[model samples]
Target chain A: GAGVSQSPSNKVTEKGKDVELRCDPISGHTALYWYRQSLGQGLEFLIYFQGNSAPDKSGLPSDRFSAERTGGSVSTLTIQRTQQEDSAVYLCASSPESNGFPNRGETQYFGPGTRLLVL
Target chain B: GESVGLHLPTLSVQEGDNSIINCAYSNSASDYFIWYKQESGKGPQFIIDIRSNMDKRQGQRVTVLLNKTVKHLSLQIAATQPGDSAVYFCAERGGLDMRFGAGTRLTVKP
Candidate 1:
Protein backbone atom coordinates (compact mmCIF):
# COMPACT_ATOMS: atom_id res chain seq x y z
CA GLY A 1 0.00 0.00 0.00
CA ALA A 2 2.66 2.50 0.80
CA GLY A 3 4.26 3.68 -2.40
CA VAL A 4 7.94 4.31 -2.86
CA SER A 5 9.23 7.17 -0.69
CA GLN A 6 12.37 9.31 -0.42
CA SER A 7 13.74 11.25 2.50
CA PRO A 8 14.89 14.86 2.82
CA SER A 9 12.36 16.31 0.43
CA ASN A 10 14.77 19.19 -0.17
CA LYS A 11 18.50 19.39 0.34
CA VAL A 12 20.79 22.35 -0.24
CA THR A 13 24.49 21.79 0.02
CA GLU A 14 27.67 23.58 -0.94
CA LYS A 15 29.57 22.48 -4.01
CA GLY A 16 32.27 19.84 -3.36
CA LYS A 17 30.32 18.55 -0.34
CA ASP A 18 29.03 15.04 -0.35
CA VAL A 19 25.28 14.35 -0.10
CA GLU A 20 23.42 11.14 0.37
CA LEU A 21 19.80 10.67 -0.70
CA ARG A 22 17.71 7.82 0.65
CA CYS A 23 14.88 5.85 -0.92
CA ASP A 24 12.42 3.37 0.55
CA PRO A 25 10.83 1.13 -1.99
CA ILE A 26 7.35 -0.34 -1.72
CA SER A 27 6.91 -3.58 0.14
CA GLY A 28 7.69 -6.66 -1.95
CA HIS A 29 9.37 -4.57 -4.63
CA THR A 30 12.76 -6.09 -5.42
CA ALA A 31 13.67 -3.82 -8.29
CA LEU A 32 14.71 -0.24 -7.60
CA TYR A 33 16.03 2.51 -9.82
CA TRP A 34 17.35 6.04 -9.46
CA TYR A 35 16.95 8.87 -11.94
CA ARG A 36 17.88 12.52 -12.16
CA GLN A 37 15.68 15.24 -13.65
CA SER A 38 17.20 18.60 -14.46
CA LEU A 39 15.14 21.73 -14.74
CA GLY A 40 12.82 21.36 -17.73
CA GLN A 41 14.61 18.18 -18.78
CA GLY A 42 13.89 14.50 -19.07
CA LEU A 43 14.76 11.82 -16.58
CA GLU A 44 18.34 10.57 -16.69
CA PHE A 45 18.97 7.02 -15.64
CA LEU A 46 21.39 6.75 -12.74
CA ILE A 47 21.51 3.29 -11.29
CA TYR A 48 19.38 0.21 -10.74
CA PHE A 49 19.29 -2.60 -8.21
CA GLN A 50 17.70 -5.98 -8.63
CA GLY A 51 17.41 -8.26 -5.65
CA ASN A 52 20.92 -9.42 -4.66
CA SER A 53 22.48 -8.94 -8.04
CA ALA A 54 25.24 -6.44 -8.61
CA PRO A 55 23.78 -3.01 -9.17
CA ASP A 56 23.81 -1.49 -12.63
CA LYS A 57 26.09 1.50 -12.42
CA SER A 58 26.52 2.12 -16.11
CA GLY A 59 24.21 5.07 -15.97
CA LEU A 60 26.27 6.86 -13.40
CA PRO A 61 27.44 10.05 -15.04
CA SER A 62 30.81 10.00 -13.34
CA ASP A 63 32.88 8.29 -10.69
CA ARG A 64 31.57 10.82 -8.21
CA PHE A 65 28.11 9.32 -8.45
CA SER A 66 27.45 6.03 -6.73
CA ALA A 67 24.53 4.13 -5.20
CA GLU A 68 23.94 1.13 -3.02
CA ARG A 69 20.94 -0.93 -1.98
CA THR A 70 21.16 -2.43 1.48
CA GLY A 71 19.45 -5.73 2.35
CA GLY A 72 17.53 -5.50 -0.89
CA SER A 73 15.20 -2.77 0.29
CA VAL A 74 16.45 0.72 0.93
CA SER A 75 18.84 2.42 -1.48
CA THR A 76 21.14 5.36 -1.02
CA LEU A 77 22.63 7.47 -3.77
CA THR A 78 25.77 9.24 -2.78
CA ILE A 79 27.30 12.06 -4.72
CA GLN A 80 30.89 12.87 -3.93
CA ARG A 81 32.19 16.37 -4.59
CA THR A 82 28.86 17.52 -5.86
CA GLN A 83 28.81 20.09 -8.62
CA GLN A 84 26.27 22.72 -9.53
CA GLU A 85 25.39 20.56 -12.52
CA ASP A 86 24.27 17.85 -10.11
CA SER A 87 21.47 20.01 -8.83
CA ALA A 88 18.22 18.40 -9.81
CA VAL A 89 15.33 16.28 -8.59
CA TYR A 90 16.44 12.81 -7.60
CA LEU A 91 13.64 10.33 -8.18
CA CYS A 92 13.45 6.73 -7.04
CA ALA A 93 11.19 4.05 -8.45
CA SER A 94 10.41 0.44 -7.72
CA SER A 95 8.74 -2.49 -9.37
CA PRO A 96 7.51 -5.93 -8.24
CA GLU A 97 9.80 -8.06 -10.35
CA SER A 98 12.52 -9.84 -8.50
CA ASN A 99 14.00 -12.20 -11.08
CA GLY A 100 14.33 -9.36 -13.62
CA PHE A 101 12.58 -11.39 -16.30
CA PRO A 102 9.15 -9.93 -15.64
CA ASN A 103 10.63 -6.45 -15.31
CA ARG A 104 10.37 -5.87 -19.01
CA GLY A 105 6.83 -4.58 -18.90
CA GLU A 106 6.43 -3.86 -15.20
CA THR A 107 5.23 -0.43 -14.22
CA GLN A 108 7.58 1.47 -11.91
CA TYR A 109 6.03 3.23 -8.93
CA PHE A 110 7.79 6.51 -8.25
CA GLY A 111 8.34 8.51 -5.08
CA PRO A 112 7.85 12.19 -4.39
CA GLY A 113 11.58 12.67 -5.10
CA THR A 114 14.30 14.55 -3.27
CA ARG A 115 15.19 17.94 -4.63
CA LEU A 116 18.93 18.51 -4.34
CA LEU A 117 20.39 21.94 -4.86
CA VAL A 118 24.12 22.31 -5.04
CA LEU A 119 25.33 25.79 -4.31
CA GLY B 1 23.38 4.26 -27.60
CA GLU B 2 19.65 4.70 -27.06
CA SER B 3 17.66 7.89 -27.05
CA VAL B 4 13.98 8.71 -26.81
CA GLY B 5 12.67 12.03 -28.06
CA LEU B 6 9.42 13.96 -28.37
CA HIS B 7 8.21 15.64 -31.51
CA LEU B 8 6.68 18.61 -29.70
CA PRO B 9 7.84 20.38 -26.60
CA THR B 10 4.34 21.62 -25.76
CA LEU B 11 0.72 21.09 -26.62
CA SER B 12 -2.33 23.19 -25.87
CA VAL B 13 -5.82 21.82 -26.16
CA GLN B 14 -9.22 23.15 -25.17
CA GLU B 15 -11.06 21.47 -22.33
CA GLY B 16 -13.14 18.50 -23.43
CA ASP B 17 -10.99 18.15 -26.54
CA ASN B 18 -8.65 15.29 -27.23
CA SER B 19 -4.89 15.48 -26.77
CA ILE B 20 -2.16 13.44 -28.37
CA ILE B 21 1.53 13.40 -27.51
CA ASN B 22 4.10 11.75 -29.75
CA CYS B 23 7.44 10.12 -29.00
CA ALA B 24 10.17 8.55 -31.11
CA TYR B 25 12.75 6.15 -29.81
CA SER B 26 16.01 5.34 -31.59
CA ASN B 27 16.36 1.86 -30.18
CA SER B 28 14.53 -0.63 -32.32
CA ALA B 29 15.36 -3.35 -29.83
CA SER B 30 13.11 -1.72 -27.25
CA ASP B 31 10.35 -4.08 -26.32
CA TYR B 32 8.42 -2.01 -23.84
CA PHE B 33 7.07 1.55 -23.75
CA ILE B 34 5.48 3.58 -20.98
CA TRP B 35 3.81 6.95 -20.61
CA TYR B 36 4.26 8.98 -17.46
CA LYS B 37 2.59 12.20 -16.32
CA GLN B 38 4.44 14.58 -14.03
CA GLU B 39 2.96 17.68 -12.50
CA SER B 40 5.01 20.56 -11.26
CA GLY B 41 7.16 19.75 -8.22
CA LYS B 42 6.09 16.11 -8.30
CA GLY B 43 7.61 12.86 -9.43
CA PRO B 44 6.44 11.21 -12.59
CA GLN B 45 3.28 9.11 -12.38
CA PHE B 46 2.73 6.13 -14.64
CA ILE B 47 -0.13 6.72 -17.02
CA ILE B 48 -0.09 3.62 -19.20
CA ASP B 49 2.21 1.09 -20.85
CA ILE B 50 2.26 -1.19 -23.83
CA ARG B 51 4.47 -4.13 -24.67
CA SER B 52 6.02 -4.60 -28.10
CA ASN B 53 3.73 -7.49 -28.81
CA MET B 54 0.69 -5.25 -28.62
CA ASP B 55 0.10 -2.35 -30.93
CA LYS B 56 -2.41 -0.63 -28.70
CA ARG B 57 -3.61 -0.63 -25.09
CA GLN B 58 -6.37 1.38 -23.46
CA GLY B 59 -6.83 2.56 -19.91
CA GLN B 60 -9.68 4.48 -18.28
CA ARG B 61 -9.44 7.54 -20.53
CA VAL B 62 -5.96 7.06 -21.91
CA THR B 63 -4.65 5.01 -24.81
CA VAL B 64 -1.09 4.11 -25.73
CA LEU B 65 -0.26 3.27 -29.30
CA LEU B 66 3.05 1.75 -30.27
CA ASN B 67 4.28 1.51 -33.83
CA LYS B 68 7.34 -0.61 -33.62
CA THR B 69 7.81 -0.48 -37.35
CA VAL B 70 8.69 3.19 -37.11
CA LYS B 71 9.90 3.16 -33.52
CA HIS B 72 7.17 5.60 -32.65
CA LEU B 73 4.79 5.78 -29.69
CA SER B 74 1.83 7.99 -28.90
CA LEU B 75 -0.40 8.68 -25.93
CA GLN B 76 -3.93 9.92 -26.50
CA ILE B 77 -6.10 11.41 -23.81
CA ALA B 78 -9.83 11.44 -24.38
CA ALA B 79 -11.83 14.50 -23.34
CA THR B 80 -8.88 16.37 -21.91
CA GLN B 81 -9.55 18.08 -18.58
CA PRO B 82 -7.81 20.83 -16.69
CA GLY B 83 -6.40 18.37 -14.25
CA ASP B 84 -4.68 16.60 -17.13
CA SER B 85 -2.36 19.52 -17.64
CA ALA B 86 1.17 18.35 -16.97
CA VAL B 87 4.42 17.19 -18.55
CA TYR B 88 4.13 13.84 -20.28
CA PHE B 89 7.14 11.65 -20.94
CA CYS B 90 7.54 8.46 -22.88
CA ALA B 91 10.05 5.83 -21.86
CA GLU B 92 11.42 2.93 -23.85
CA ARG B 93 12.96 -0.14 -22.35
CA GLY B 94 15.14 -2.82 -23.84
CA GLY B 95 16.56 -5.45 -21.60
CA LEU B 96 17.65 -3.67 -18.44
CA ASP B 97 18.23 -0.29 -20.09
CA MET B 98 15.47 2.26 -20.07
CA ARG B 99 15.51 5.64 -21.77
CA PHE B 100 13.15 8.55 -21.28
CA GLY B 101 12.12 11.18 -23.81
CA ALA B 102 12.15 14.90 -23.23
CA GLY B 103 8.70 15.62 -21.84
CA THR B 104 5.86 17.33 -23.67
CA ARG B 105 4.09 19.96 -21.62
CA LEU B 106 0.32 19.71 -21.99
CA THR B 107 -1.72 22.79 -21.13
CA VAL B 108 -5.46 22.38 -21.14
CA LYS B 109 -7.14 25.69 -21.92
CA PRO B 110 -10.58 26.25 -20.49
Candidate 2:
Protein backbone atom coordinates (compact mmCIF):
# COMPACT_ATOMS: atom_id res chain seq x y z
CA GLY A 1 0.00 0.00 0.00
CA ALA A 2 1.15 3.47 -0.73
CA GLY A 3 2.18 5.58 2.25
CA VAL A 4 1.97 9.29 2.91
CA SER A 5 3.93 11.48 0.50
CA GLN A 6 5.35 15.02 0.54
CA SER A 7 6.84 17.24 -2.15
CA PRO A 8 9.92 19.41 -2.53
CA SER A 9 12.33 17.21 -0.60
CA ASN A 10 14.46 20.32 -0.06
CA LYS A 11 13.67 23.99 -0.36
CA VAL A 12 15.89 27.02 0.08
CA THR A 13 14.36 30.44 0.16
CA GLU A 14 15.14 33.95 1.30
CA LYS A 15 13.61 35.43 4.40
CA GLY A 16 10.17 37.03 3.97
CA LYS A 17 9.30 34.71 1.08
CA ASP A 18 6.25 32.55 1.34
CA VAL A 19 6.46 28.79 0.86
CA GLU A 20 3.88 26.10 0.43
CA LEU A 21 4.52 22.51 1.40
CA ARG A 22 2.23 19.77 0.24
CA CYS A 23 1.19 16.47 1.77
CA ASP A 24 -0.76 13.59 0.29
CA PRO A 25 -2.12 11.22 2.88
CA ILE A 26 -2.68 7.54 2.32
CA SER A 27 -5.98 6.52 0.88
CA GLY A 28 -8.78 6.40 3.47
CA HIS A 29 -6.70 7.98 6.21
CA THR A 30 -9.03 10.39 7.94
CA ALA A 31 -6.48 11.88 10.27
CA LEU A 32 -3.68 14.07 8.97
CA TYR A 33 -1.06 15.99 10.91
CA TRP A 34 1.79 18.40 10.30
CA TYR A 35 4.89 18.90 12.39
CA ARG A 36 8.11 20.86 12.36
CA GLN A 37 11.51 19.72 13.54
CA SER A 38 14.31 22.17 14.06
CA LEU A 39 17.96 21.25 14.01
CA GLY A 40 18.76 18.99 16.95
CA GLN A 41 15.22 19.54 18.29
CA GLY A 42 12.12 17.46 18.79
CA LEU A 43 9.07 17.25 16.63
CA GLU A 44 6.79 20.27 17.12
CA PHE A 45 3.15 19.75 16.32
CA LEU A 46 1.79 22.23 13.83
CA ILE A 47 -1.72 21.39 12.75
CA TYR A 48 -4.10 18.48 12.34
CA PHE A 49 -7.14 17.62 10.26
CA GLN A 50 -9.80 15.04 10.88
CA GLY A 51 -12.29 14.26 8.16
CA ASN A 52 -13.86 17.57 6.98
CA SER A 53 -13.90 19.27 10.33
CA ALA A 54 -11.96 22.47 11.09
CA PRO A 55 -8.25 21.87 11.35
CA ASP A 56 -6.51 22.22 14.69
CA LYS A 57 -4.07 25.09 14.50
CA SER A 58 -3.20 25.44 18.15
CA GLY A 59 0.39 24.43 17.60
CA LEU A 60 1.17 26.96 14.95
CA PRO A 61 4.09 29.03 16.17
CA SER A 62 2.68 32.29 14.79
CA ASP A 63 -0.02 33.84 12.69
CA ARG A 64 2.16 33.50 9.65
CA PHE A 65 1.68 29.75 9.66
CA SER A 66 -1.47 28.22 8.18
CA ALA A 67 -2.60 24.94 6.67
CA GLU A 68 -5.56 23.62 4.75
CA ARG A 69 -6.60 20.10 3.86
CA THR A 70 -8.62 20.21 0.72
CA GLY A 71 -11.10 17.39 -0.02
CA GLY A 72 -10.00 15.75 3.22
CA SER A 73 -6.89 14.25 1.71
CA VAL A 74 -4.26 16.67 0.47
CA SER A 75 -2.88 19.22 2.95
CA THR A 76 -0.70 22.19 2.42
CA LEU A 77 1.22 24.15 5.04
CA THR A 78 1.79 27.76 4.15
CA ILE A 79 4.27 29.95 5.94
CA GLN A 80 3.93 33.61 5.11
CA ARG A 81 6.91 35.92 5.25
CA THR A 82 9.12 33.11 6.38
CA GLN A 83 11.79 33.92 8.89
CA GLN A 84 15.22 32.45 9.26
CA GLU A 85 14.01 30.72 12.38
CA ASP A 86 11.35 28.91 10.35
CA SER A 87 14.00 26.75 8.76
CA ALA A 88 13.36 23.14 9.68
CA VAL A 89 12.11 19.80 8.41
CA TYR A 90 8.36 19.86 7.82
CA LEU A 91 6.88 16.41 8.36
CA CYS A 92 3.44 15.10 7.49
CA ALA A 93 1.70 12.02 8.84
CA SER A 94 -1.65 10.29 8.54
CA SER A 95 -3.65 7.71 10.42
CA PRO A 96 -6.63 5.49 9.74
CA GLU A 97 -8.42 6.55 12.89
CA SER A 98 -11.79 8.17 12.37
CA ASN A 99 -13.30 11.07 14.28
CA GLY A 100 -15.13 8.67 16.60
CA PHE A 101 -11.95 6.99 17.79
CA PRO A 102 -11.62 6.87 21.54
CA ASN A 103 -8.07 8.18 21.50
CA ARG A 104 -6.01 10.26 19.08
CA GLY A 105 -3.00 8.04 19.44
CA GLU A 106 -3.55 5.92 16.37
CA THR A 107 -0.49 4.73 14.51
CA GLN A 108 0.85 7.40 12.21
CA TYR A 109 2.62 6.82 8.90
CA PHE A 110 4.95 9.65 8.00
CA GLY A 111 6.36 11.03 4.78
CA PRO A 112 9.99 11.74 4.09
CA GLY A 113 9.36 15.41 4.90
CA THR A 114 10.40 18.63 3.21
CA ARG A 115 13.52 20.31 4.46
CA LEU A 116 13.03 24.07 4.35
CA LEU A 117 15.94 26.41 4.71
CA VAL A 118 15.18 30.10 5.17
CA LEU A 119 18.12 32.39 4.63
CA GLY B 1 1.55 22.97 28.31
CA GLU B 2 2.38 19.30 28.33
CA SER B 3 5.70 17.86 27.13
CA VAL B 4 7.59 14.57 26.78
CA GLY B 5 11.28 14.42 27.64
CA LEU B 6 14.17 11.99 27.59
CA HIS B 7 16.75 11.39 30.30
CA LEU B 8 19.62 10.98 27.86
CA PRO B 9 20.15 12.60 24.49
CA THR B 10 22.37 9.79 23.29
CA LEU B 11 23.12 6.16 23.99
CA SER B 12 25.80 3.80 22.70
CA VAL B 13 25.83 0.01 22.91
CA GLN B 14 27.82 -2.81 21.42
CA GLU B 15 26.24 -4.72 18.61
CA GLY B 16 24.14 -7.66 19.77
CA ASP B 17 23.68 -6.03 23.21
CA ASN B 18 20.43 -4.73 24.59
CA SER B 19 19.53 -1.03 24.77
CA ILE B 20 17.01 0.86 26.83
CA ILE B 21 15.69 4.37 26.20
CA ASN B 22 13.75 6.18 28.90
CA CYS B 23 11.19 8.97 28.62
CA ALA B 24 9.22 11.11 31.06
CA TYR B 25 5.92 12.76 30.33
CA SER B 26 4.24 15.50 32.36
CA ASN B 27 0.63 15.11 31.28
CA SER B 28 -1.35 12.78 33.48
CA ALA B 29 -4.26 12.91 31.04
CA SER B 30 -2.19 11.17 28.42
CA ASP B 31 -3.84 7.89 27.52
CA TYR B 32 -1.53 6.58 24.83
CA PHE B 33 2.19 6.51 24.16
CA ILE B 34 4.22 5.67 21.05
CA TRP B 35 7.84 5.16 20.10
CA TYR B 36 9.33 6.11 16.76
CA LYS B 37 12.69 5.71 15.08
CA GLN B 38 14.08 8.15 12.55
CA GLU B 39 17.16 7.63 10.46
CA SER B 40 19.13 10.39 8.83
CA GLY B 41 17.33 12.22 5.99
CA LYS B 42 14.09 10.48 6.83
CA GLY B 43 10.88 10.95 8.76
CA PRO B 44 10.03 9.03 11.89
CA GLN B 45 8.82 5.44 11.61
CA PHE B 46 6.47 4.03 14.22
CA ILE B 47 8.15 1.37 16.32
CA ILE B 48 5.71 0.41 19.03
CA ASP B 49 2.86 1.81 21.08
CA ILE B 50 1.04 1.12 24.32
CA ARG B 51 -2.15 2.36 25.86
CA SER B 52 -2.21 3.65 29.39
CA ASN B 53 -4.17 0.66 30.62
CA MET B 54 -1.36 -1.69 29.66
CA ASP B 55 1.89 -1.58 31.57
CA LYS B 56 3.94 -3.40 28.95
CA ARG B 57 3.78 -4.57 25.38
CA GLN B 58 6.19 -6.59 23.28
CA GLY B 59 7.05 -6.80 19.62
CA GLN B 60 9.81 -8.45 17.64
CA ARG B 61 13.05 -7.61 19.40
CA VAL B 62 11.39 -4.55 20.97
CA THR B 63 9.41 -3.84 24.12
CA VAL B 64 7.53 -0.78 25.32
CA LEU B 65 6.75 -0.15 28.98
CA LEU B 66 4.40 2.52 30.20
CA ASN B 67 4.04 3.52 33.84
CA LYS B 68 1.22 6.00 34.20
CA THR B 69 1.56 6.30 37.97
CA VAL B 70 5.02 7.75 37.54
CA LYS B 71 4.51 9.25 34.09
CA HIS B 72 7.37 7.23 32.71
CA LEU B 73 7.93 5.22 29.54
CA SER B 74 10.75 3.13 28.19
CA LEU B 75 11.65 1.25 25.01
CA GLN B 76 13.96 -1.72 25.16
CA ILE B 77 15.62 -3.29 22.15
CA ALA B 78 17.19 -6.71 22.37
CA ALA B 79 20.25 -7.78 20.39
CA THR B 80 20.72 -4.33 18.98
CA GLN B 81 22.14 -4.30 15.48
CA PRO B 82 23.80 -1.71 13.29
CA GLY B 83 20.49 -1.05 11.61
CA ASP B 84 19.07 -0.08 15.01
CA SER B 85 21.25 3.02 15.18
CA ALA B 86 19.02 6.03 14.83
CA VAL B 87 17.12 8.70 16.75
CA TYR B 88 14.36 7.26 18.91
CA PHE B 89 11.47 9.42 20.09
CA CYS B 90 8.67 8.97 22.57
CA ALA B 91 5.31 10.64 22.13
CA GLU B 92 2.50 11.08 24.62
CA ARG B 93 -1.06 11.57 23.47
CA GLY B 94 -3.24 14.05 25.38
CA GLY B 95 -6.42 15.65 24.21
CA LEU B 96 -6.32 16.08 20.43
CA ASP B 97 -2.56 16.47 20.29
CA MET B 98 0.52 14.39 20.92
CA ARG B 99 3.76 15.80 22.27
CA PHE B 100 7.10 14.31 21.24
CA GLY B 101 10.36 14.29 23.14
CA ALA B 102 13.68 15.54 21.83
CA GLY B 103 14.67 11.92 21.05
CA THR B 104 17.70 9.84 21.93
CA ARG B 105 20.33 8.97 19.35
CA LEU B 106 21.34 5.34 19.58
CA THR B 107 24.67 4.14 18.25
CA VAL B 108 25.37 0.45 17.85
CA LYS B 109 29.08 -0.11 17.84
CA PRO B 110 30.32 -3.26 16.19
lDDT for B80 (candidate 1): 99
RMSD of 1: 2.6
Estimate, for each residue in B1-110, the C-alpha lDDT of model 1 and write its tens digit. 12334343889999999999999898889988899999988889999999899999999999999988888899999999999999998989887678888788899999
Clashes of 2: 0
Per-chain TM-score, chain A, candidate 2:
0.93
Model 2 chain A: weakest 10-residue lDDT segment is A97-106
For model 2 chain B, where is the 10-residue window of minimal lDDT? B1-10
* Weakest 10 consecutive residues of candidate 1 chain B by summed lDDT: B1-10
Residue-wise lDDT of candidate 1 within A11-115, one digit each (tens)?
A: 999999999999999988888889998877788888888874545777899999988888889989999999999999999999887464636336899999999
Clashing pairs in 1: none
Which is the leading candidate under TM-score?
2
Clashing residue pairs in candidate 2 (N, C-alpha, C atoms within 3 angstroms): none
lDDT tens digits by residue: candidate 2, A1-106: 8899999899999999999999999998888889998877898888878875645678999999988888989989999999999999999999887656722567
Top-DockQ structure, candidate number: 2
